[model samples]
Target: MYVMTLTKSDFEAFKELIKVTLEEQTETFLATKEDIKHLPTKDEFYSKMDEIMGELKATREEVVMFSDLNRKVNDHDERIEKIENNCVILFLFT
Candidate 1:
């Protein structure tokens, strides 16, 4: 084991360091509280969220409609191709 010794001056300097640290931390706590006070109220936040959700729902519906239309277009294209092939076959036979 090792023994260490501190002078009176060393003790006073240690007390000063503790006081400075507590003061800095207290200031930081107060600053954080002040920052939190500036945040949006719960109702305001909820309304903004609602607006965004509404827009997302509308966009989702539009996407579904577009997908259905795309499926119909592909079906129509297949039907037209079949009709064209039948016409060509008839012309060749005649």
Candidate 2:
């Protein structure tokens, strides 16, 4: 279990990085012409495609990590609320 401690500024920076990486990837893909005859061999194109796919997968995993962190934070808050409620009940009963 890894604990992530990110401030609002950290998240903003992450968001910008993801945005820039995605935009650059999109530009690279678009610059590739559809005319295979003028382009690299099928094998070379496939290799490049695989590399881009790997990058996309890594970016997706980063997003998922952020999402998981958010879920864990919510879980911690809920647990705290439950504990507070339990304390209130105990006080009333005593």
Q: Write the per-residue lDDT of candidate 1 for residues 1-94, one digit (tens) a residue.
A: 9989999999999999999999999987775656888788999999999999999999999999999999999999999999999999999999
lDDT of 2 by residue, 5-46 (tens): 999999999999999999999877774456445878889999
> Each candidate's root-mean-square deviation in Å?
3.1, 28.4
Best by TM-score: 1
The top-ranked prediction according to lDDT is: 1
- lDDT, model 2, position 21: 100
lDDT of each prediction vs. the true structure?
0.95, 0.93
Model 2 steric clash pairs = none
